[model samples]
Target: MSVVILTIKISHFINHVNKMLGKVNEEDLKSVIDNTKRLTGNLARISDNLDEKEIANLIKSAVAKS
Candidate 1:
């Protein structure tokens, strides 16, 4: 997904967490949000580098063998 969508989802998650657990530490929450953004960005980059056609072919080969 796009970064915009990821940000909106993250914001909603933080809001939900805040509501469920009152008085969360701002520093801790900030750390979590930052880490999440970093991790998702890395994952998106990795996924972008992958060859979708190659992966699909591999999957099809495996299924055909089975």
Candidate 2:
């Protein structure tokens, strides 16, 4: 339930951001979506092998880069 709610909230936030940005290039948006999907899938498959600290660091790194 929490995962579903969080996904919905994140989707809404992405939509809001997209609207605010206005006139986004379709190819760039598609590339970002594709990369995000690939990253999430890879993370899900390897999550059991990662510790909480490693996961937190990965999130921090990604956030910093973005």
Candidate 3:
């Protein structure tokens, strides 16, 4: 996927999470979002391309880090 698409996906996830639960901690949510974006950027640079597995791994690693 392109950076634009990846960014959209991340935004969607954040919105979805926010909608599903009330009273989320702003700092924690932002941390997750930032880590996700960082991981996506790293994986994109690593492969210079996007694939399902790469995207999945990037998300997994970011979540794990958090």
Best by lDDT: 2
Tens digits of per-residue lDDT, candidate 1, 18-47, equal: 896677777888899998899678656756
**Candidate 1 deviant stretches above 4 angstroms:** 1-19, 51-66
Segments of candidate 3 deviating more than 4 angstroms: 1-19, 49-66
TM-score of each: 0.44, 0.54, 0.43
Error of 2 at 37 (Å): 0.2
Instruction: Rank candidates by lDDT, best first.
Output: 2, 3, 1
| Cα error, candidate 1, residue 35 (Å) | 0.4
User: Candidate 2 at 65: error in angstroms?
Assistant: 5.5
- Report, for every candidate in turn, its global Cα lDDT versus the true structure: 0.80, 0.89, 0.84
lDDT of 1 at 21: 63
- Can you give the lDDT of residue 54 in candidate 1? 64
What TM-score would you give candidate 2 relative to the actual structure? 0.54
Candidate that beats the other on TM-score, 1 or 2, i.e. the better one? 2
What is the per-residue lDDT of model 2 for residues 5-58, given as tens digits with 9 covering 90 to 100? 999999999999989668788888889899999999988876888988898898
Q: Model 2 scores what on Cα lDDT?
A: 0.89
For each candidate in turn, give its C-alpha RMSD to the true structure in angstroms: 10.8, 7.5, 10.5
- On TM-score, the candidate that comes out on top is 2
lDDT string, candidate 3, 1-66, tens digits: 999999999999999987866676778879989988996678768776777888789779868998
